[model samples]
Target: MLAFAGAGLWLLLAGPADVLGIDSGNAGMVLLMTATWTALYQVGRLPPEDVVRVGSPAEWKAWIGTAFMAAAIAYFLTRGEVLAGVTVFNDPHAQRIGRNLVLLLVAWSVLSSVMASRWKGVVEQDERDREIAAQASGWGRGALVAVVIGLAVLLGLSPASRLAWASHLMIANLLIFALMWSCFVEYAATAAYYWRERRWQ
Candidate 1:
């Protein structure tokens, strides 16, 4: 979460021109590759029992959702040239990337849904889970609202020339990033709660 947030901040500070000069698409691909390898290494390190626990249906759902959300935000922001170019809406390559990402997200959701149906009888949520979810949801919503307000204020105060560069695609990407960031925060909070609760138990 911190890494993603940092990347977003870097893009904002560097601006499109700087990002383009630095080849943001290559940077994004490198980051994605690193993340993939890290995930694989962590999974390989898990013991059999730990692997089973991690592979549980509910855990799988959470992992898939988090991964998809992060990937969507990252890919859209980078692959669509939102960081590298003036406007994603006007770039044919960016549009194609965006379409492919949407399709990938939809496919992932459908697959997760199918898996959930198969595991419906085995997977059960308890009061603790519900409490954690409620708390996380509240945090996520609050964070998202704060981000929206902050962006609004910044845009409102910016000069006309600066605002002119803030195209529709840029605004949309900002919102998407905020939403994904909130979700990441919510997941992190929930994970922390679970860790503490387990430690106490």
Candidate 2:
């Protein structure tokens, strides 16, 4: 939910609507993504377990790939030309990564759900899995909170002249980075736990 909504808003805020090339149905797609977000969020504010489908530890490890892919798409589309030297890409300030991020999140969510459901009724996960998840989630969320607080302090204490790059669009990017960083931390931690615990068997 956060992934989809945040990404969609990330693009829409870069709007004048026209700058997004919305005449090609990207606008409808963003609207659809937002509507889906609203619907999911409105469903009684469901518990995380109810909404987040879990698969085997191996499957969870695979999700790290999804997070990395989303991050790559965000970079290549928004700022790839910076390294690639192609005039076809023109997001110097990274105001457009959200469009790609939204698509990647939605696609990855659907794919992960379908994959997770393959284990339905068989009950693959055990208490150990849950323990790792709890621990990993704490690592992820704690890292996110700490980074956001650090950013707040940096922005608050720094002289305005030194912080001129922190525009509204850039702040949006920072929020996006924070979320992505958390997911990376969580997924990587989960994978690491599984790998380390495998020696116990």
Please give, for residues 4-48, the per-residue lDDT of candidate 1 as tens digits.
Answer: 544643442232533556544334434544454455456556664
**How much lDDT does each candidate structure score?**
0.61, 0.58
lDDT of 2 by residue, 1-201 (tens): 666655554553333445445532255345545655465346326443553343353445445444444444454445433333322234533334445556656655774565455445645567877788889899989979987998899999999988656666556656767887777777778877776776575
Cα displacement (angstroms), candidate 2, residue 134, comes to 0.6
Candidate 1 is scored at a TM of: 0.63
| Model 2 poorest 10 in a row by lDDT | 80-89
What's the C-alpha lDDT at position 50 in model 1? 62
TM agreement with the true structure for every prediction: 0.63, 0.59
Question: In angstroms, how far off is 105's CA in candidate 1?
Answer: 1.8
lDDT of 2 at 195: 67
lDDT of model number 2: 0.58
